[model samples]
Target chain A: MRHPSYLLACLYLLSLSACTSVTIDEYQRAEASLASGDRIVLLGRRHSPDYETEPDLINCVGKVISANQSGISVIPEKQFVDELYPWFEPRMAPMRPERLEYLMKQPQVREKIEDLKLRYVIWIDGSTQQTGSAGSVGCAVGPGGGGCFGFGTWDDKSDYEAEVWDYQKQDLVAKVSADAKGTSYMPALVVPIPLLARVQSNACKGLGAQLREIFVPDSSANAGA
Target chain B: MKKQLSRSLLMLSSLILAACSSQLTVKGQFPSPLTTAMPLHGAAYYSPELISHSYAEDDEDRVKWNIQTGAAQQEFFDSLLPALFQQWAGHSPDPEGEAFKLPGVDIIVKPTLSDFQYSLPRETRSKIFEVWIKYNMQLYQNDGQLLADWFITAYGKTPSGFMQSDEAAMNEAIIVALRDLGANLTVNFSRVPELQDWMGKRDSSVQQQSADRGGVQNETP
Candidate 1:
């Protein structure tokens, strides 16, 4: 013969303890990994840009050319102007036109091209459609195991993608792809916010590792390149 | 009497056991509503370089955009305004319908360029986009009286590296702006009790007027 009050108290405590927690340590690790190098450049595309893979290919090649022991220099093939500042007059007034023109022609701007260096570049392409479900249900299991009931469930999904390009010889060296998915309850006790960050970090990590493998070979010739 | 007391205790125990065995669960349902609002009506105004500090005279000669931080503040706001309007509108009582009646709020957002300096390993140099945007909002009443005036600012940085497409960089800027705006708005709204009350009342009145008209009010003005 067991006491029912004791069992009820135990159940309440157990349910309360089930609350989910988020770990900032995971985010810190991801941030630390990204901050480790200075030469690498991360570029993202809005949707997938359709071009003869040349620009993409060239960017990858640029990465390989820019690769150094310090880190790889990744550059997007296209010059991204700030749409927010379309008209160059006021926003760029402080920047001397001649200076910008000169900088573009600067040896450094053309570093990898002139130096003939090898580097790694990643281009994120395409978005993903994700789906997920979550819920809670209250039920009663009798001595005879007859009474059972269902409570609730939830589902959600978001779309995004990353296309990674590794440049080694002014040619596309390597390409990698990653996707993110998320779902949670109404108030999203555990999933949405924290999970979204995790998804992004994981995707970036995957893309980075994949690009590293493609560009960095174990052979002596390519070991440092 | 003893037997009766024993039976009562047995019943009490049984009731407790039964209650404990059954679980009570509550489920909350929330539609994944689009959190963005229609773009706010505003423009990014650029001014000539307030101060020039670069050593390169050629750098000073570049035809600067209205605002000289690497990215354009106006373009960023254009893409971002609609979404922000939609988000702010969404949080309101009549998100879909009453937003338009409030008339478009006029916001002048300007970005101040600060400290765009970067150094390479052996002293190679690059530029940084250390920019801050100041948002001046004037909320107008139907009668043209300024209902609320607010000033909010946000900061973001673009390190020296491969410059992505203008659109991509702009999108990133917008995202940063939106995040900052959300936080600023949340804090502002929470702290200003009178504004919140006024907004609530105005929305309710708008809803009532629509109901009296026997039709829904169109959100677009």
Candidate 2:
């Protein structure tokens, strides 16, 4: 019965930690669809001075979308930026669909996009930040050995939004956003046991799944056909 | 045997201490800007010192750093100037010689690395390395009249990563700064007041010459 109390406490701690809630909201102005040969490029917005959207998050979403969806190709962000060169650099990239019209007017850029069969440009902006943190863990080492004893906990929030621009139509077709929040903990008696909440990855998967649903509504149906 | 062991320990300590210093050779890939080429022949002149520029700093804590960016700057302009003008030419003087004016060049551009500075993660109490570069750009006409003299400043920063070397982080920061320089120069070149005035006058003069030639042709019949 005494050991059962330890089990109950463990369950309580696990319940308090590692619980991530992800919410996704999508706005579509027009019908958005993707063809088999069409390509999509994911770019992170880096113009903000305070915080930059992490390249890792962009890559994670790209991987998730490509892994789950069929007949969809995702262009690597660096490749796309490098192929277009200075035009797509952080300061020079088009922030709005209207500015993209001017970019398309450039013959080389237009030709490259056409040659690559690029259909959509998804601009992901936002970052994950530590909203709050409390508690601390301490460890000691001596001639005999070393052990850690304490409890530490922190909260993180991630907010990201994706703006999908259609190349042919030269308009913003869809806007999707994801927000996630979670708390992580590390409890130590003799050894520290870490329970990390995957807030950024959860947000990435949520956003990726929503993007896939918009691009491919009936993936199974398409597959059977 | 004790003396030999002490010497070995001394050598190991020196090796560990030497690892704290960093030397970085910055390299970058510059892209041609996306703008219509102006109908002018521009000659770019880079001094030998600019081509071999390096910034070295020794801090109070005995940490030394040297960053070489001269070759990268030269390459950046070599790719940028040709795409900005209809005709492009490059001129470089020998180490001991002075750069002379080109015969048929419409405009000459001289750029110099004025200043370079950086900050380390430990100093800033943050997980990022930052670099700033300042350049002085001088534009002259074929007759040696100064058209525009301006300063362009660029900044770059990279977040420090776990298990990443200081040299790698600094190199990435330099590359970012170089890219930023390209973006600023390409987008803001035509907007310079002196350049705009000179270009407007040059275009009108060319139009006048064409009109005079047409009048002469009309009278010949």
Candidate 3:
């Protein structure tokens, strides 16, 4: 027979483990065929009238992809931004479907991508936000010092999407989306120590791996080596 | 030996009790009616101003419709509404994750819960005991333009004792409101004059097409 204490310990660990996830939802997929000469860039700086750019997440995923160094040439986010700055500002901003179509039809834009051999421009967008929380974690503020106690859990979730535009072909070839929600605990022990979920990490890993899988086709060859 | 045994027993008890801690989550009503009705596309958000006031009204009975934690309240709306809108608008790569933030699409929606009230059930089949949700929503372009603004109220009419026990009716009321909001947006969006103005600026072809069609559709349900 199993010991009750052992079972209890297992249960405690299981609850903690449940607070992280990696979910990959591919909206559209690309051909697994190798594009050896094709260069791809993940556009990290999202063109938004509102909301700050997710530089950390952009860099994290970029680093992950560059580390893989697979078939698709990862052009690096910094280089991609710097190379296309000043120009392509109005062209890349998110707009209506018809407007984007018109943009892709532009002679100057098409020529630029063709000249650069920039086969794919993956527009990446995502953010981490708290979803739901339960219980109560309160605190006090004073001169000597502030202390917080009580137990509460906030649901932190990371959502990411990549729109792969075949700039040369002037078409949106693939779209990859990953969103994960995890609960974070704020246990008040004189101060609120937040056990944040690795939402961004999970999303980054999920998206990076999926992008590689779709574009690179073979991942094991690059694994560990 | 006795003290060690007692400590182990206490540890075991604590672990068992930990599972019983209040596990709160925000849920959404599914299969929005607008999905099939309107084959359109759009984005959604929850403004920080609206999210800043994330509290539900308290009950004298202290029973239903009481969202004690502000974070949980915000999360519930953030996760649920945008996902619903994504499907309703036929948005590929849905806007659930980017709720209340700029979605960078043609049509932008902001859903704010202005107020709500939950009344406990008195009888088994009485409409008197109901939950109400007052929702304020807006649709606009990314370029700081407002298209449509709608203020809607939804009712959750439950005649059951179980439904009213823990503010279940109130949550249901919210779903009702969201469904109505989706349907309204789908039917009424094309009627927004600003959308035509937007189309004129973004794509001249669309404006030409509008002129060729005589005019943009003026019908609204």
Q: In model 3, what is the error at residue B39, expressed in angstroms?
A: 47
* DockQ score of each predicted structure, in the order shown: 0.02, 0.47, 0.01
Residue B220 Cα positional deviation in candidate 2, in Å, after optimal superposition: 4.5
Per-residue error for A124 in candidate 2, Å, reads 0.7
Q: Compose the digit string of candidate 2's lDDT tens values, residues B58-147.
A: 666746898888999899889887777888877633212345455677878888999999888898866678889999998887766678
Cα-based lDDT at residue B109, candidate 3: 66
Share of native C-alpha contacts between chains A and B (below 8 angstroms) recovered by candidate 1: 0.00
Give candidate 1 misplaced runs (Cα > 4 Å). A1-225, B1-34, B38-74, B84-128, B162-196, B206-221
Alpha carbon deviation, residue B126, candidate 2 (Å): 4.8
lDDT measured at residue B108 in model 1 versus the true structure, 0 to 100: 31
Error of 3 at B176 (Å): 39
Candidate 1 lDDT over B1-221, as tens digits, reads 99999999999998875553312111111111112232334333233341221222134333222223333333333444344343332111121224334345433333333323222112223222333455554444433344456676654333333455332333344343433443454234334454456667867998998787765345435
CAPRI tier of model 2: acceptable
Score candidate 1 by DockQ: 0.02
C-alpha lDDT of residue B99 in model 2: 50
Winning model by DockQ? 2
Model 2 global lDDT (CA atoms, 0 to 1): 0.84
Clashing pairs in 2: none
